[model samples]
Target: MSRAKGNLAEDKACKFLDENGFMIIERNFYSRFGEIDIIATKDEVLHFVEVKSGLDYESAIQNITPQKLSRLLRTGDVYMKKNSLDVDFMYDAIIVTPQDVELVDNITI
Candidate 1:
């Protein structure tokens, strides 16, 4: 997808998360490993969110391959260590489609 479209989806994802009571901490956090799309906190746990958009949920979700997940994990670790954070955290994904935005939490590698 184009960068513009990705940003739009991320903007929508941020709105969705904010409305759901998550406090947005950062966006596009980059490290040598990769980039994390969004970082938020809710109920004292940190969320590392990856925004994926497509015509449907399955198509969008499929974009998060194993290699991509590994990158996310490594980047998340870099984020925590760099910030000196020791809080609970989990990898997540936000699937944005024409119909709605969905959050899939606790994504595993």
Candidate 2:
């Protein structure tokens, strides 16, 4: 996707997360492997979120492939180690389409 679309998606995701009670911690966190789109805390658990936007949910969700999940998982590991976070965390995705945005949590690779 274009950078503009990605930015829009991220912005929408930030708003969605904030409204859902997650305190924003960081964004666009990078590691050697790849980038994590968003990081936040909900209650005591940390969330590593990926923002994906498209004309529809099918196209949006299609972007999150196994390879992408692997990269995100690797980056998540790096983040936890760097931050010395021993609490709970999970991988999540915010899918944005023309009509609405949806949050999918604890996604498995």
Candidate 3:
């Protein structure tokens, strides 16, 4: 998808997360490995979120391939180490569709 559309979906995802009690820490954090679409904190756990959007949930979710997940994991590690963070963290994905935004937590590579 285009960057504009991706940004829009990320915006929606951020709103959803904020409304659900997550504090937005950052957006579009980039490292040599990859970009994390959103970073937030909830219940003292840091979340590295990937935003994916399509006409439907399955189509959007399919975009998170194994390689992409690996990139996310590496990027998340970079973020934590750079910030000297030792707290609990997890990888997650926010699927944005026309009808809804869904958060899938604890994604593993």
Candidate 4:
């Protein structure tokens, strides 16, 4: 997707998260490995979130392949180390489709 489209999807995802009571701590967090689209905290657990949008849920979720997951994990580790955040955390993905949004947690690699 184009950068503008990606940005718009990310914005929408952020809005959805905020509405659902997630406190957004950061967005577009980058490290040598890759970028994490959103970082949020809820119920004391830090979330490293990857945002993916598509015409359908299948495509959106498929975007997070193993290589992509690896990059997100690497960046998440960098973020935690840099911020000295030693707390509960997990990998999450927010899938935004034309009809609805879905949040999937603990996306273990």
Candidate 5:
């Protein structure tokens, strides 16, 4: 999607996360590896979130290809290292659709 659309989705995802008790620590963090859409914390665990939005769930979710996941993981590592953070963390995805937004935590393969 375009940059504007991506920003909008990330904004919505931030709102959703904030409402659900995730403190928004950062947004659009970048590194040599790639960019992390959102960095949030809840229950003492950091979440590196990827925000994907489309007309439906499948289209949005399919955007998170393996290459993308690899980039996210690498970037998350870079973030932790750069910040000297040794806390627990996990990769996550926020699926935004016209009807609703859902947060899938600990989205491991």
Candidate 6:
């Protein structure tokens, strides 16, 4: 998808997360490895979120391949180190579709 589309999707994802009681800390955080779409916190645990949008949930989720996960890990490490954060964190994904949006937490490689 295009950059604009990605931004739109991320906006929606942010709103969704907000409604679900998450505090958004950052958006479009960058590092040499890649970008972490959103950083949020809830119940004292930090969440690194990846926003993926497509015609369907499967297609969007499929975009998060192993390589992408690797980059997220590396970028997340960079974020934590740069900010001197020492909190519990987990990888997550928000799948955005025309029908609905879903949050998948605790994603693992």
- Structural similarity to truth (TM-score) of each candidate: 0.98, 0.97, 0.98, 0.97, 0.97, 0.98
How well is each residue in 1-109 modelled by candidate 6, as lDDT tens digits? Answer: 8999999999999999999999999999999899999999999999999999999999999999999999999999999999999999999999999999999988884
lDDT of 1 by residue, 1-109 (tens): 9999999999999999999999999999999999999999999999999999999999999999999999999999999999999999999999999998999988894
**How far does residue 104 in candidate 1 sit from its true spot (Å)?**
0.4
Per-residue lDDT for 93 in model 6?
Answer: 99
The list of candidate 5 runs beyond 4 A from truth reads none
lDDT of 4 by residue, 2-102 (tens): 99989989999999999999999999998999999999999999999999999999999999999999999999999999999899999999998989988
CA lDDT, candidate 5, residue 12:
96
Q: Which ten residues in a row have the lowest lDDT in candidate 3?
A: 100-109
User: Model 3: runs farther than 4 Å from truth?
Assistant: none
Candidate 5 per-residue lDDT over residues 70-108, each given as its tens digit:
999999999999999999999999999999999988777
What is the Cα-based lDDT of residue 104 in candidate 4? 91
Rank list by lDDT: 1, 6, 3, 2, 5, 4
For model 2, residues 1-109, the per-residue Cα lDDT tens digits are 8899899999999999999999999999999999999999998999999999999999999999999999999999999999898998899999999899899988874
In model 4, the runs with Cα more than 4 Å from the true position are none
Poorest stretch of ten by lDDT in candidate 6: 100-109
lDDT string, candidate 3, 7-60, tens digits: 999999999999999999999999999999999999999999999999999999
Model 4 whole-model lDDT (C-alpha atoms): 0.94
Q: lDDT of all predictions, in order shown? A: 0.97, 0.95, 0.95, 0.94, 0.94, 0.96
